[model samples]
Target: MSTPSYALRDSMTMLRRNLKHARRYPSMTISIVAMPILMMLLFVYVLGGALGSGIGLPNGADDRSGYINYLAPGIILMAATSGAVATAVSVCTDMTEGIINRFRTMPISRGSVLTGHVVGSVVQTMVSLTLVIAVALAIGFRPHATPLDWIAAIGLLALLTFALTWLAAAMGLVARTVESASNAPMPLTFLPFLGSAFVPPESMPAGIRWFAEYQPFTPINETVRGLLTGTPIGNSGLAALAWCVGLALAGYGWARIAFRRHAKR
Candidate 1:
């Protein structure tokens, strides 16, 4: 086989291995998926009224359905981040185990190992995102988006998933243990709260509002929300794409460096 063929075969093997691991230990993925759903239910049922009123819902009235529609995009992003955290923990575990050393001694492509984790994580993220969206739809989260808007939203999500999964893989490489790896991605999970995920950034205090408006998550959130609700996306879509691409490149470089250093040690 050619070099490319060999790499593809090796990567596919690793991808299957990772997928099997996910199947055997489904708890992590389940927990990741559950968090977003629970948060959605909590906010929509419990806090929706107050938050809707505070945000001044469309037509100048509080409505849970309106809030649900606004909140679904953020929760979907949360699901993606949570899945990334799962990737970090899984990668950390693989690094700590003897299997990675064994693979290094074999003829398999080195980069395939990282590729497997990233691809698997992205798949898992997509599943979680789908489930969250299904739940949102079931709960009266109606979107006014056209088919083109849906395509754009999915594309944006795929990009975000790729970037975040790679970053999580880097985090895994940097962590000495699975516990640390698990914790490393926690801040990402919390980032949505600080962005325009649930409430308008303008409603926040001056300092907080500045951070919310300027942060990467805010633009991404806004873009997704706009795509779903027929709101004008303006420059947010471009900003979100830029952030995803930049982070992906940075994380890919970092992961490669970390892996090389680990191999040397």
Candidate 2:
């Protein structure tokens, strides 16, 4: 039998276990899954008009797509970020309750545990994101880009979500409790609001504008929006990729190290 084959086998096995857990806690799963849906409705229908008008987007939009397009990426980010919190809490609980300890004694590969959960969280976040997009359709939001644009937009957001899941895994392993674990993603979650997530960062106060300008989320948000709208990335896509790759590597390194240390201990 090939050795690398065993790794794939172990990953699948671990994934099955995680899916079972998700099935058992429908409420936890739904809460994790539905946040994007709820927020999309709340922000797009209820708040989009006033919010869009305030943005000074042109007096007559070619269509009523202003805020929903702006809000779509933010909702996607919010959806992905919210699901990551569940990842932390789930891992923290396993660690605290010694479920992870029990798993360690089993025959599974060590990375399988965290890696499995990361995959599940990414899949879950994507589901939430799909719901948000569906709601966007109902609200009459249309992408200016072609089919390729939709593909790229989804692909970029999915990559970003995976990167975030790895970082969230680090929090899950090291945090002492559920609350602490969930807190790790909070700062990143708040990052978008400061950037062009809701309103354009240029409209902010001078001090706030300075902070939003260089913050990593600005480029990422701009990159996602550009994909949806067919707007040019204008030199920022490279910066966005650098941020995503950097954070992903850092988070994965920290999380991997933490997992190994915990197993040894």
**Best-performing candidate as measured by TM-score:** 1
RMSD of each: 1.1, 2.0
lDDT of 1 by residue, 1-265 (tens): 9999999999999999999999999999899999999999999999998898788755333777678878998998888788878989999998998678999999999999999999998998898899999999999888889999999998898888899899999999989999999999898898999998899888999999999999889999999989998667799989999998998898899999999999998
Q: Which lDDT tens digits does candidate 2 get at residues 33-122?
A: 576678778777787878787776532432236777777777766766677787888788888999888887787777888878889888
Give the Cα lDDT of each candidate: 0.90, 0.79
- Which 10-residue span in candidate 2 carries the lowest summed lDDT? 56-65
Model 2 lDDT at residue 244 = 84
In angstroms, give how far residue 188 of model 2 lies from its true place.
2.0
- Give the clashing residue pairs of candidate 2, or none: none
Residue ranges of candidate 2 with Cα displaced over 4 Å = 58-65
